[model samples]
Target: MGLGLRWYHFALWAGFILVMALMPEFVSKGTLRTMIFANFLAIFAISWDVLSGRTGYISFGHPFLIGIGAYTTAILTKRFDVPVEYAIPAAIAMTMVGGTIMFLPALRIKGSYFALVSLAFMELIYQLVQVIRPDLTGGTRGMSGIVTLTRGAANGYYLSFSLMIIVALSMWLLMRTRLGTALSAIAMNEESVKGSGLSPTKLKLFAFMTSAFVAGLGGAFYVHYLGSIAPRALFDINFVFTIIVATLIGGASTIVGPMFGAFFLTFLLEYLRPFLPGAERYLIYGAIALLLYMYQPKGLYHIFMSQLDRFKKSGDDD
Candidate 1:
């Protein structure tokens, strides 16, 4: 399918970019830092959605995949003396390879079995990095002095935000194409998609590869930006929960939803910091998430559309 870009899409994205570019003038450095995390989270959430969200495969092992990208680039740059340009792409390639290995199990298994296998993959990585090559992997302490792409929070914010926009815009446009329609159709009914003569295996593999590409790109850049990597933190279940909750709360199977969810969740945590400055905050946070999921399982994006449609119908009636 052609671009099918509309005037409203241009207007909306332009307005968003303009506001984000101007945000440094209004928000505190702390908020900027928070937004930076949100940007990365959006990238990760988008990665999750393209495969698991859109294709009916729930992957609980994203951090495992992301960690591969992060660790790969970090090792190449730190241990092998590779340039940033080459290191990043190499890391992405490794991630795709890792993703292919990850996808092999998916061909045979699905549903919770698929999710459990994915989780096991991540846990296996966590243990392997520490034991296999502690020198390169940095083991329990992890690696440092890695090259950083940006210096300050301001610069970091700009870099991350720009990357987020690029990935979001590209993925959104891609999903608007006929290939996107086929992928979503698989999610709805794989049997029907096969009947239509589309190979579900190929489509799923493509989706996994795309997701791996994103995870690799985002993970590689994130490590360089942070100038470090730690296995325990990267492979943690809490991190996976954050990603899944962000995607679910934002709206699964939609690019824009995850972007919004990341910001909203990040800001919500920020606001709660003063009242609950410790891990206890997650109790309240998780409660809110549960309530929202219970009420509107489709997430905030669906709610927005519902309201917009109601407004339109009201105007028509009037």
Candidate 2:
């Protein structure tokens, strides 16, 4: 359960934070806003990576967990007049409970079956919110004018980036521990993990809970940042696709990969806006993501590391 961290790990993290902290001085406000989305997207992407990416769970209904957090906080803050501090924690707790419920299906099903069940859960919740209690849930139209956490783009960017970094660093350290190795083992071979005397059930539960925790935190903060929530938007398949694609395209099992992937995808879409300016922009974005994933299935992180290693070897030869 030791961290197993190296000196370079801390150095690299410090360098990245320093660079990002100085970005506002160099970038425009519009770019700062774009970065804010990237930050939150990174958080969601990491959450997915922790569960599906690590455990081979392949959650098609991750939006189910995220929506729980978002809707929970939204209702608590708007309908009940709950403080943001209290509401966010409640949202996270509710999400973990939702995650635990989702785990029940995993006990009997897996692979595509498990994925389908997760998707069903997402759809079920989507329909429930609209029909069950429109007054508090905001129904189909959704809720707006919710309390915002930050005042402007710069502040929003800082707050989001800080949260993303904290999550990334924490997850990184956690995954470096024996529990992380156990979860990854479950992804590779549940039977083997069982043979080794580790309980696959408990490992899967840990992964689910961890994923839900991060998803809740991200979803809660994301709604506050936008000061709104919509059922369609929160539970959209496109949103789920973006999150999964970001994780895979960035490199799944590794945390830093998803974070970088989120930024890459966000900026790519932002730069494509002037040229495409419509939903069609996603077509080009998807094409590029496909090409990059095909080129380096291990993701940009692995590609970068491989190149760095090659350079060092070449210098040694010289």
Candidate 3:
């Protein structure tokens, strides 16, 4: 059943990708810009899913890891005048270091306590970025005119879309492996995984490191795409909320779910602009999200699978 379902999912994704590849032909340039943001959001959301969603680590400070990557590359390229090619990899390395720092807390903390610690880490970075090195970090204003990896809307769209697809496909394949099952097992019960002769610590370290790598890669590339970065933008609670919400609403622990969530939330926000056009729109959006999450905590993925099962069963019965 799992194998059959996997094939079905794979085919569906293939078709979806074909459609997405052709989307630029139909949509306006502004919509393509929005898609670029959605792609990055999906990357960050998927990165969060690998650790928090799969392992049940519930990291609220994921942006901290992402910020470390973004800032590392930003400072390296902006101040030191390093080439983006070298700086991007350095940024990813910095995020790994930051992830290791986070892993230390994960050793002692779990659940809500762990979440609080992550949040604190994010807040710490937020403050430090503003105060500690105003000269290099650019203080509150942040560095601008950093760099662009591509020119024009179509090129930018393709760059982001290709990155998103590669990350999504890579993560999707990884999660299908035994390691993925083991990590998910850790989420269910760490003690059980240990009793089964696998070190939970090692599995978790792997998860954290991998998660940080993707987040960092996405953050670094995203910065270059925008050619700018700010402390507030990188470390914002709202930003964290968006990543988490996208993952949850689309279905946590499922790579495709977060991508769907990113696009869904992005388009929803765009659709609402004509109606609400202000902060209050989010109030409505939040209410809908809260209700859906409470009703189906597993998210739209489960809902989708359930419906598909029903359809198949009905066909079999007929």
* Descending-lDDT candidate ranking: 2, 1, 3
* Top model number, lDDT: 2
Q: Compose the digit string of candidate 3's lDDT tens values, residues 97-161.
A: 99989989888789999999999999999999889979988899988988789988778889999
- Root-mean-square deviation (CA) per prediction: 1.3, 1.1, 1.9
Clashing pairs in 1: none
Q: Each candidate's TM vs. the true structure?
A: 0.96, 0.97, 0.95
Global lDDT of model 2: 0.93
Candidate 1 structure lDDT: 0.91
Ranking by TM-score: 2, 1, 3
After superposing candidate 2 on the true structure, give the runs of residues whose Cα lies further than 4 Å from its correct spot: 315-318
Better of 1 and 3 by TM-score: 1
Question: Between candidates 1 and 3, which one is better according to lDDT?
Answer: 1
- Tens digits of per-residue lDDT, candidate 1, 1-318, equal 687887978999999999999998898898899999999999999999898889988899998779999999999999999999999999999999989989999888888999999999999999999999899999988899999999888999999999999999999899889888888998799889999999999999999999999999999989998998988789999889888888899998888888898888888888999999998877887998899999999999899889988998999999
State the C-alpha lDDT per candidate.
0.91, 0.93, 0.90
Which is the leading candidate under TM-score? 2
